[model samples]
Target chain A: MTTRILTPEELALLSLVQDELVPSYGDLPPAGTLGAALTVDAYLAEQPRLRRPVLTTLRAIEVRAGKAPFAELDAGRRVEVLRKVENADPESFSELVKQTYNAYYTRPDIQASLGIDNPPQPLGFELPAFDESRLSRVRAMGKLWRDD
Target chain B: MAAPELDSDVLIVGSGASGAAAAWSLSRGGLRVTCLEQGRWVDPSEYAHSRPDYELARQTSFAKDPNVRGWAADYPINNSGTPIYPLMVNAVGGSTVHWSGHFPRMRPSDFRVRTLDGVADDWPFTYWDLEPYYDLNDSMVGVSGLAGDPANPPRSPRQTPPLAFDAGCEAYLRGLENLGWHWWPCDNALISEPFGENRSPCNCCGPCDIGCPIGAMSSAHVTYWPKALAQGVQLITHARVEQITVDHAGQATGALYYDDHGVRRSHTAGVVVMAANGVGTPRLLLNSTSARFPNGLANNSGVVGAYLMFHPVAFVSGVFEEVVNGQRGPIGGLMNCQEFYETDLARGFVRGFELQLSRSVGPLSVANGGILGHPVPWGSEHHEALRSRYAHTMTTSVMLEDLPEPENRVTLDPELTDAHGIPAPRVEYRAGENTQRMLEFSIARARELFEAAGAVEILVDPLVQESGWHLMGTCRMGDDPERSVINGWGQAHECSNLFVIDGSTFTTSAAVNPTSTIQAVALRCADWLGRNYRDVAA
Candidate 1:
């Protein structure tokens, strides 16, 4: 039961928030389309310390919606609920947003889209060799050290 | 039951920068040296940058702040009043294992603060007195820089070429050039040319602070400890010294420590060296209460943990329209403008600051939130925000000179303690008025530079809380025993055979980083101890 952390309805609500946080634009799909919420769900299970804060933010928005589940709220109402939660408890709001992005961007597909397939190591980026000619003008000034 | 106590000719309390240098110097003079280090020796292969999840490790195991990355070896620090958080790593190399490797020597006037600015007291020794030692350390560490920098005195030519300013850094150089301000290529411990078989030339990994993926960066573990070990110096890892044990006659006998398996043990020596840095050194001294020295070990002057200093940092970043190399190359070794480093009372401050080009966020950082003042929207604008920020921004970190103030100090915290139940150190500090004034002046100057460099938007932060890397001046050295904890040549004023070779013994904190100066001073002190140990020990 601990392994299967998030309930189906809770996962659906989280997915809806993730979708709104990163909506589909151009040819790309929204975060929900890439199962970013599922990724976050797995992350939350891995880091149980984050479970309370993540749930607090989600529940705050859900409770802000009168009678309707956050997953069933209209897009405009969803934004209003999110904004209220953000205004009321910004730390928790920011926490969920940060974790969502971490889950999203670390995906293989997202890395491909960002044009950085490999990590920064093993094959680091190429930088232009520093040209010493840049020193000619500055070198002419000579020993500006304050010795007096 | 306690373990059998060991004895040595010389006992060093830490295996970090100063300890490594002291060990190597003393062993070369044919002394038996044994170093007790609290932390494990981190494998280079296990460094953060070697894995794909590099940035993640920085938030966890490899974090500079001991508080955030609560490894077993780390001690808690209470940074309540000060804006800057104490950032350090508890490993064989200490914080140098995770440093950005920006090595700059202090200017000549730095040692004569009272004579120059009428503020803090002068150091017991002058920069010229230490110049030869600095050159020796530079040669031993394999620094990369161009000599003949107008801002500092002439020196031996750098071993390798400096990391060239990339397309993005050129923007700032052009801005400074247009403004006619003095700028220079920064000296760095990070090597640009290949040296020994173990180390290779830089791979241009952007996150060098997370422990260099390649051995290009100079750290004590890679640079000095190898030579010291080759000279037959004994390094005992996971030996956390809790107290500097003193003999019945009030001389430093050795240390009492917890071994790897948590067994209490003692090691006696003819001479004792304290290289555990500003916070740790003072903490150990204060905790070592006794019949002869109830106040602390060699602390009869009551200045064991006084005059703590940190280069209070303020970050100024700018957003530009054109995207250049975002996360490539060495961050700290690129370029620096020291136009305002020397004291100029007319600028509304007695001392001044240095503006060094710093890091921009990686893709994950941008995705989290754009910048300090700028927030990236998550919806339709997320990609655009990430693209605009990652690699497209330039940050100039203003390092303000922290004058020595008795109030800005590290004291034993009343409530907090480390894992082994030793009372942790708490920092009671506030940015002095002079430092604040320098920040305002530097901010305006950075804004002008950014505008001149054609930045579309400028971001300003008054203080960077996580920028406290240069730790110094908790157990200062001076000529008078009444006015200082230690004296010239880093010998404790109260205990004859006791020595302090770490940043704790600094008299003043310059605006520049302290790694190179600390090593140079350590070399000088080790040389003195090697020559005069017979008199002191007797």
Candidate 2:
């Protein structure tokens, strides 16, 4: 369980990947620096079983980012390509987005540095932001449809 | 590494409700009880936050072994008529840790089913006999409910009040009421408010099927193990019991088992309690071949693993207009109807079902429905469907009680050892004709109720007549040694000091959840062991 390092090039590619996936407002740091700081390569190296799937998923993300052969795309084109993929299949993009997010969120250094909000809470206790107006309207409509 | 040899006054196998309860009871009695649990203790606080971390990918659903590498079933959902079905949980607290916590005591008539209704065999003990122990078990586990339901026997005062039913739940209630069925609040083993020392109130997050993070649900880890530890019970986790050892005089000696690290060890005790659940209990006994008892340990009657039973559960789901945050709270949040419990010759089914009401839906479930055409009227139909339907829908799940038959039994496979190299419990089971009829009736009733509730579209999932969870009847209780595995007091007929306290000892499958009754019997057995230890030892 020792710390390991990710190559700078791989870190930059991972960052370029994350920048395209998450909503800009969702409080995430740039992926490259976070990936570098996380020792992503070392973690993956230890998990030999997950290596193939992880690589395949990253390659899929790169292709979706229009970085054919992955190594070619700049950061801007990667974002544009990801937006297209996200629009086409949000389900497939979700895993990549979540992985990139967790990659940063799980690292203690990145977590503290970014002030990410992933504190411990009881199971099923996470509250969604309440939009009273939306909820009230929904409730009113539901009342109308009541079989009672 | 050399495995440590262990010895104790009591060697209890399996750490679910039964083992945990026995451990607590024996430990409190000043006995050197050693509990051998195959699964390791997983701290609740480890993944308390981040509910998604404990999903299927995490593989920690309902106290089953997280490390189980392959699917137990050779194939998925058997649509063909296969009599055999598998049910099991291999975890620290066994299945009890992850159960829905629906704690209903078996009714008085449930025990004397053969004598009263002549369908199943009569249990050696009656509900009146188990009443006090049931109360004690309920109090220990902290059940929350209201009494005075005319259908059920009067219950002792619950530790807490029933959970509040949500707004959408009334629709289903009305439908059940319209059909002239009586419904009552379910007896839940969850803390509605603060109870005895260290226990906290349930916040009703609705994901009790997954491990409860706050310890509000009555898993054995929270309920019995704590008391057992306080009373000096020695719990040996990851020690899988292989066989029960008996001496030349037909007396119980102890057991042989392997630790998590796969080193074999032996423990000697005056009494051996096989609380290894319905499946595990019989498997261990059958595997314990010896010169004195070659068939199996205490298999004098050749009925070590016969008459297995589990209630066939069918789930129903629908779409409503408002967001019913169904993803929170313990399973079976509400119990709407049980008027069908009585046997009606006219209904063409021997046993009736108890309707469990719940509305907890997770994101995966929501996403599942959205693709299944449950949502919007869309395009032009969008606003109309979204405005009118989603929040108003609520579903009632029926747990149909199945009759116990000898053909449905447990036996060992020549193949399949567990991760620790112990043979896995091979279950041979099938739903009886009576149970099949009950499922058909229950499904039709469910559809009727939904239609009456003005459901625009109601989808009925195929009936799965078997679940491995509520396993019972393999080592059933009765009066005659030739016919039964255990006596009325839960003592083995062949071995006086040996006992089976879990669902394996149940003679009949009650229409409700079995955890409360299992805990109750464990407590009663422990009490009996405390009084009669000297007589048996001599």
Candidate 3:
């Protein structure tokens, strides 16, 4: 609940961007629905060097949307604004996209939607029994290198 | 300030794979052995693979990079000039705790690389000399492998059965068969069935590199250290050894170390064994300057920190139609194809490489950035790719043989120092032409294997410099004192009672993982020491 890393304005801009990156689609919730923007805030809180770059990008997007907050912009206008910002500072925009995707996709709910068990541990999935006959041919290849 | 001193019959400077093996052998042979580990034991409860926040846990605690993990006992490495940033762990089991448990023995041809290929220096002894010790170490550590691997020489029976093959390995095996290439189930240092009293069968938790919680994978902490401790081998944790104290006769008398409480202490012993790994061993030796040996202890030839070798790796990933469940089995590759492991004059490279078919990627790994030149797509395409590639991707690592180069070495940094105020180890390395050629050839072969397996999409990673896992050849072994630091028996040539029993004594790195050979050599060194105990104690 700590809002020290991201201000209300920055969080609102990030949420709008997160939704566009991963919109809700047929049983899968959008990035904003999973609270990924808050996760980004928490992640950047530990990495002080990355905090300014992310906030500056958000502020730029808001300003480019005609003096209006990014969240209040039309969906088409939001996409157009993001495209412009991406062209200007591609590396920063790419970093933002990566962080948003990572935070959204790693959530347990998102994992369930993707048919993946979140940690893949404690009760690990079992594989099909080994078919010995499949390896018979490779086993027959026999000593291809010079051992002596 | 005056330092407190302790005494032991035999003192080992590390508690890693080689150090633990030596401790087991020497203590069982009736010597009072003591091992000094710079890091503390890993808490089993803190092993976080079972939790939902596993990726976060890995970044905070279990990362391979020392600077990223930021453990207290971890030392800094100056990687400015090195091709690869050094990857190592500093716990009781050392890097073994985070290893993938790929245990392949060096071939007989590897021992005579100089005579056969006329490229690198040969080992002082042959593979036959260490074969028995390799079998012994395998039995001790419980290797899960088949008996007749056509790629290797005939060996004794394995302690356990081979790990069950997954769909990815099956496809790779079929592909290798189609290509008429030599392939075999990897000799893994993991228990497939219950063996030892404390050990259990692998449950396939898929995080073997992050310290197995169930004592299934044969890390030194769960395998050798327990037996060594039972034999009364004393292990002193959080002891950062700075230098080896030598006598006026150039004999190793003891070691100066900093304890957990930041107190400078000394441990005197009749014999001192340096099992502090390739980087740490050389750093300690170069720092241990004395009046008789002003350059460094047992470094009379100035080759103590030279000839560093690490396997230059190339990666390839293939996307299959079937759901292979890439995150189900062991973290390492399942099958090993060494079709080009030997020297062939037809190829540009003197020595060749090994291809390990790995299937251990997870959804998060794919999401972060798909490995092996397959960048994860963004926007709408991202979800579709993740759904398709998360369980369908198969990867291979082309482990190339790197020859001994004197310039590729670990030296002490002039400016940087560790928490204990000792000079940090600085690595300087670059891939030679031979390695580069081998990587090129191996990557092409890997792509062919993927194609033969009917992969839908094949992604090739030209070279990965960060795959510097096998640290070797910093304190090389040979017959002559002028050429090597240690002899065939791992005994220091310049100093009689000084010994080095680690990957640091490797003369030439083979095209495979080095842990099995490291443990085997340590066991051989211990046997030699036991036989010559009377001479060494004098």
Candidate 4:
């Protein structure tokens, strides 16, 4: 049986952060829409060392949001609250950002949006033809190393 | 209480680059050769690049650092004493399974560093002595490179045409031309086109570091091991060698090892060759203490694990406007500049470094702190940065030459042990002043090259601690028995029947990658042993 590491409220807070970080840009979906927060949760569950710090950082951000829950706050207010948390603990915030990006960028939908069809796999990409002309100057230089 | 014993004419430990080459060369001479590899053969079907979540392999199965990868066969090393953590693979092909296939030969000047630059000790043999072997190994591995590289001395032609250059390579070439510096297509072990029966052409999968599935990359498993196996060389996988047993006369008799099921076993051989790499070789020797040699098995000179060296690396990345499509080709550098490879007294360093231009890493790799200077920002700025820099960045890796320091040695950890209850190898290293100066100069040169290429943003990462792949000089070769463990022929000075054919026997850490040279030296060692096998066996 699998244990859930993130609380429902904490997962909601993380989803809010993910949406703000990688929001919808025209046709592109936000990171939350792609389920990046759930991926991050799965990753943190396996990595016991990172779970405590990540959960603590999210809690601090929740407190900084004030008045309303972090998930209910407006985008502008959420950004302001995140800015305060980032300034206070840049290392933890940076680590969270890296984790979020790692989860978001590896999604199949995101990969499709980036035009990378399929994993670079059983059939790899074709490269440009080799050009011998590029070696003209190097050949003309002719044996630059000293023998002695 | 007795271990089961097997017998062979020759016992080779570790089936990596050097061991596999030696096995192929010696097995062809009609001698019964047996090789013991700690790790099992990698199945081509299980290669990470074929899966949907291939990018995550960099942190899991394909990680450069073994501790991070956490394979069962891997042993932990105490890296507290050294600034850089030593990295190696334990599979049959060893680190070659995860290498980028950059095959560069050490220059003629690299052999005589003491005579030329007065910094490191000179190798007993010269570059000319190993030229034929180098050519032979190149032919066997099927190198894909152009002939007539001006930076290197004249050599035999490569087996195939060089890999095609992408836009990133062209930009780097233009930058080198603008500075009037020497640059050339890198000699890669990856086959550009199908030539030999053993392998096929590379498909530009861009993940050569995680074991090529199509047998395009020249790993030992696809190159030498196949030939060795065909020649009837017995290969035992998942066999962790514990120590080399010696006779009373101080000659190598056999080796004690742990089998796949952790059962104790032994292999008796006329000649025992230790090709277990720099760190593993030293650890084995240090642990093989007996009544005759209290300090170690071959420690008469008390230098069994002394004079360790590694190539200190510096990285620089440049952001260009044009999309370079960095994910299409080999992950190794597309081009290399060796203009500053020779020593210059004016540069405040005795030796120099090589500048290789690399394309941007995969999307996940870059997002997880693989970028050099700045952290990836959050919010809308994060998406903007990724869109612009995803396929547009070019990196330059500066591989600096490191001199041997006696204090920078490998010793057995007093408390730490592997799964087999053998003491783990402990690394003690600190970069010398010369290496530090060379790194600074190389980073500056990389920045200049980026500027010359007309990059908008230049990022520099100087002297990362995790870049310790080139292991050498632990059991260095020399004529002086009092100071060196092995001789010119890779025969141990204390034990005539014992030989070490690997990066461990290197006298100096050359500026270039050491894989090709290690194979060349192993081939040369096999040649010497094959010629004198009758007398050695007697």
Top TM-score model: 1
Write down the DockQ of candidate 3. Answer: 0.54
- TM-score, model 2 to reference: 0.76
Q: Per-residue lDDT tens digits of candidate 1, residues B330-442?
A: 76677888888887778998867789876565676667643354557776677777777776888888887898888888888999998788899998888888888888899
On residues B1-538, what C-alpha lDDT tens digit does candidate 3 reach at each position?
0112437788999999999999999998788888999998998887877776565555558877786777998999898878777788899998988778999999999999988888778899999999999999998999987777777888898888788787878778668878888887888998888998777788777877677888888889988999999999999999999999987788888899999999999998888999999999999999999997888888879999999998888889888899877777887838898888888879887988899878756666676655554547655566787777888888899898899999999999999999988999999999898888887888899999999998898887787755777889999999978889999999998998999999999999999999999999999999999888768852
True contacts kept of 1: 0.64
lDDT of each: 0.82, 0.65, 0.84, 0.85
Chain A vs. true chain A, TM-score per model, equals 0.89, 0.45, 0.86, 0.90
For every candidate, what share of the true interface contacts is present?
Answer: 0.64, 0.11, 0.51, 0.73
In Å, residue B203's CA in model 4 sits off its true spot by 1.4
Runs of candidate 4 with Cα error greater than 4 angstroms are: A1-4, A45-53, A59-68, A72-77, A80-94, B1-6, B371-374
Q: Local error of candidate 3 at B339, Å?
A: 1.1
- Candidate ranking under DockQ, highest first, comes to 4, 1, 3, 2
Question: Best lDDT goes to which candidate?
Answer: 4
- Return the TM-score for chain B, candidate 1: 0.97
TM-score of each: 0.96, 0.76, 0.94, 0.95
Badly placed stretches (over 4 Å) of model 2 are A1-148, B1-6, B48-89, B368-393
DockQ of predictions, in order shown: 0.64, 0.08, 0.54, 0.68
lDDT (10s digit) by residue, model 2, range B274-317: 99888779988988888877888878788888887877776565
* Candidate 1 interface RMSD value: 1.9
List, residue by residue over A1-148, the lDDT tens digit for candidate 2: 2334445545555555654442232343454434532444554565454445445555566567552644477656665665676666655555444445445434554434333233223423433321223223222322110001
Listed for every candidate in order, the interface RMSD values in angstroms are: 1.9, 12.9, 2.2, 1.5
